[model samples]
Target: MRVAALWFPDWPVQAAKLECDDELQEPLVIAAQHRVVVCSQAARAAGIRRGMKVRHAQAAAPELTVIDANPDRDGRMFASLAGSLDDVAASVEVLRPGLVVADLKAAGAFHGGEDVALEMLVDAAARRGIDTLAGAADEIATAVIAARSGQVVPPGESAAYLARQPLAVLTAETALAADADTVKTLGQLGITTLGELAAIPPAAMTTRFGVHGAHIHRIAAAAPDRRVAPELPVADLAVAITPEDPIERVDAAAFAARALAASLHERLKEAGRNCVRLKVVAELETGQRVERVWRTREALTESATADRVRWQLDGWLTSGGAGAITSLILEPLELMAPDAVGELWADRASTDDARRVVERVQSQLGIDAVLQPRLIGGRGVAERIQLVPFGEAAPPVEEKTWPGAIPAPLPARLGGGIDHPASRVTLIDATGKPVIVTAEALLAGEPYALAWGDKKYLLTGWAGPWPVDEGWWASDANRHRVARLQAVGREGGPQGDVTGWLLVWSRRSWRVEAVY
Candidate 1:
């Protein structure tokens, strides 16, 4: 297959500039995890490179403007660019946010030649104030490499073209790259070019580096390339809803869209397929129709599809150009086998059965009636658990190094609930004075006894006044400055059973937070 690759260099930087109005003339870099992932031409000129520490980049370029890398922002901005390529190619497969590969033969024939087709693609991107490099070769890997320098290899010269490229090209942000260890080992062994790597016997490469070695060797040899899997034809998977009344409000439209999304997903699940692209169609009350195609790098889940539908409807209904929506339809434009992405363990039949049962219950009850507990990032145990509606994706939890989070060996039972009375308790010192956590986060006195309602327990062992100050920036009503203590107590005689208590000192009172 003759494939063509279109690449936008420094895509994250470009996306950031477009979305945030960052000056392209200035030195700019997109940093993630304190390391530079992408840098603009100006920044590169100043000696800032990808994978450099943010601090080091700043030190190299005093005027460097650093923006946090956001994968979603990059993908969102590139969607339009990928969609535009459909005008020139029969089908476009986005390799990443800023790179796309497609079968070049048909487009080349239609546009007179491959060169003209590539030029058209570059021009199309140029029209959008973006610079794009395009290249075509018999193999997708070779074409991607040639795109870096905007060179097109002759139809039968892909092997020759790849032979001259450095082995480092394998690491050029493409799916074809070998792992870092493999590349490093090869470089150490004096295999610094694709030709050198290809010189080794295929069996030798396979024995030495396993599957990855054999794969790259084939690319270097320009063997028959893998066919580009484009978006599948919409088969009969389209699901639609026509509300009895014109859906003018966003809430009502969302309700209908959720049901439609669920139905579409059910059909896909039955077929053992997933969709990467979705086409949302809305027919307005005034006979006007509006539609849009939303694409993702991964298959869209049920919640994600519903969110896109709701967002599309909201935009249409809120705009004065469109009237109330009378009909909504969702169509899966691109389909793939479920395993194309990834799958869970093979022994998940019981899990699937449980999911089906939960879904049936959700259908009978309201969507909100069923809830699932999700672990979130927080300092306290109760704060870390969030209840979300079943079947919907949980909210993304922020990655944080919670410095003062509670230690493990979490309590076996929580102490606060509407149905259960508050397990209010008091901790007293040896002299009978209430134990307190001083402002300095230190225990004022050792806990000697635990008082709960009419029962008093003698404390045998205790630890901590581990303190956590949270939400200090919020209003006083919302701020919390509390301390916790773990204590073991005996209720009756010396032979009585021992119980562990998790106590919290808040609002100048001791309360039972949990029991173990």
Candidate 2:
């Protein structure tokens, strides 16, 4: 496998430098949160190194320009840079702010071989105003080291090339190991050759150096090359945000969400992919992280993304005083081709319109005021319907047509004195005349009289007493409930339009229930 590694050097420091020194091409060092993160090639030449405190770096090169680390800015820039490489590499895997690995076996051929591919990759990075080193090898780890150290070894020679490298080359040296008495540098051990290290008995070595040492020995022997194939094509990208200051309010989640969504959009566009699901992880500065996912057909518009984020933030803020949001991560769960289209035009249009209305209403009233009615299958009218937030996906629609289904035009709501069974009343006219309703009469024609509220009215039409018995399992049982109606002349006169009909009770003291 022809593998290539793109090393960022000190990405955090580089990212910081890109921030303040737009014209900076000279040696620079950047420290953030008091830790030295990067040293420019110039600084390196001047004996300034990464991980050196800003103070020490300055002592080494008094003219060294320093920058503060900003992860968000760095993440965004990294994403943009990654986006630019879509045409060059078959696949791009970002290791951090500054480093990325690209599968260049085929890409090298396409670019006219290894040397050309290396030059093109370097040129691409330079075009983005970022400095990078590219190295190719038969193994990814070897490529990574070559890129870092600017050493190139041909195929079938990786192990031979790595042989002369010291133990430090394996990056296994630690502060404690440096101070320990087993003080043999890999070079000093005469195991400079990877083959020599591989010749060590694995079982015995495990007892001597533990698993990490055995692993390092394997890597030195180039074991990973035999196992590491070209990586699978990446589907989506993710970014996490950790605020410097703790967020005390939930509203912070919204801001974080918006930022993450925008980043996701940029990444998807670069990959030539469209995402249908976005997973948002909002972490409070105080260490509370809540994750939620939203489903959508296209990348959410910036404003819409912000709105949903704001909703989530506000919910958290109002529900509990979360410390500031410390971090936020957005992940794509589902990917579709960038050009894919959907068939639900009408449904999409209506949903979009409804969303707008819901937003407007939520802004006018409190967030809790707007809700979407969800139909459920049950006996209790209240239980049969539920209200959920508008943006949330609606619950599945039930195909339940209960045996004792209510009338065709069921009232949006039902109300009366108190909810109980066995209540009765007589039907009367507008003039308070009682009209007996038999089963036959009920079906024949609309009853003329129905009394309610100490007054009588003519019934233009009548419908169900569709009895609904809810809470069957409860200790207290329910009774039969029915619905009937009454009508009347307008306030103007008989010549005036017929005032809308009203739902009237069927038993003894009739009461008006609804107006149509």
How much is the lDDT of residue 273 in candidate 2?
Answer: 62
Q: What is the TM-score of each candidate against the true structure?
A: 0.56, 0.42
lDDT of 1 by residue, 340-418 (tens): 2123343422353455455544544457878998888777767778889887766577887778777889888778831
Best-fitting candidate, measured by TM-score?
A: 1
Residues 292-348 of candidate 2 have per-residue lDDT tens digits of 444442344444455544554454444344445666677766666633233435543
Model 1 score (lDDT) = 0.77
In model 2, where do residues sit more than 4 Å from their true spots? 25-27, 33-35, 45-47, 50-52, 172-196, 224-516
- C-alpha-based local distance difference test score of model 2: 0.56
Those runs of model 1 whose alpha carbons end farther than 4 Å from true positions after fitting are 19-25, 31-35, 51-59, 66-73, 83-87, 175-191, 196-218, 226-266, 274-516
lDDT of each: 0.77, 0.56
